[model samples]
Target: GAGIKSLFGGEITQYVTMMEESRDEALQRAIEHAKDLGANGIIAIRFDSNEISDVMQEILVYGTAVVVEKE
Candidate 1:
């Protein structure tokens, strides 16, 4: 599919959608984990992506969890 599409060389929307979904999933999981740790907020968030293979990809997110209090 991609091999043929690459000949034209334009935006690959399918891959865009897939990667967006992956990034959202990774971010949501990170938020859930921070919640589990009783964190009221997160700081210094960052994301990274990698290609394990032609078809396989990885999306990861990490941050510092912090408890915020109203003064």
Candidate 2:
């Protein structure tokens, strides 16, 4: 495994969607977070879920935002 660290979190009003789309949304959020931090890349990314309510849910996206040095 590469050097890894958890980073960023995003939650939206759990819109029911296909699994693949959900993953995309989470990935987008994570990527945006990294971009905000001026990170060149993110590694060791992971996702998680939490039941906010019977009707509402939350998604957490995390990754290691890395400043890649160009040689």
Candidate 3:
């Protein structure tokens, strides 16, 4: 993905900021979904992104939700 400079003046770039926010939101949603399905944990987590347009992008976070048993 292409990088963008911060409009407000900062060390962190816009692209990095966007990705961080997106990742946090996606992970939160994934965890909530897993909980709804009665999953104890999420495994094999992965993140993927695609450029939808010049100034737009899509982020996807996926993982397997599994139940664990303690012996």
Candidate 3: which stretches are off by over 4 Å? 1-12
- 4-71 per-residue lDDT for model 3 (tens digits): 44667554565687788998899999999999999989999999999999988888998999999999
Could you tell me how far off, in angstroms, the CA of residue 8 lies in candidate 3 after the best superposition? 18
Model 3: residue 33 alpha-carbon error in angstroms: 0.3
Ordered from best to worst TM-score, the candidate numbers read 1, 3, 2
Which segments of candidate 2 are over 4 A away from where they belong?
1-19
TM-score of each: 0.85, 0.63, 0.79
Give Cα-based local distance difference scores for all models.
0.84, 0.72, 0.86
lDDT of 1 by residue, 1-71 (tens): 22324458876778877878888899889889999999988999999988899889899898999999999
Candidate 1: residue pairs that collide: none
Q: Against the true structure, whose TM-score is highest?
A: 1
Model 2 agreement with the true structure over 1-71: per-residue lDDT tens digits: 11223344333323434434666888998899899999989999888877789865567788899999969
Candidate 3 at 59: error in angstroms?
0.8
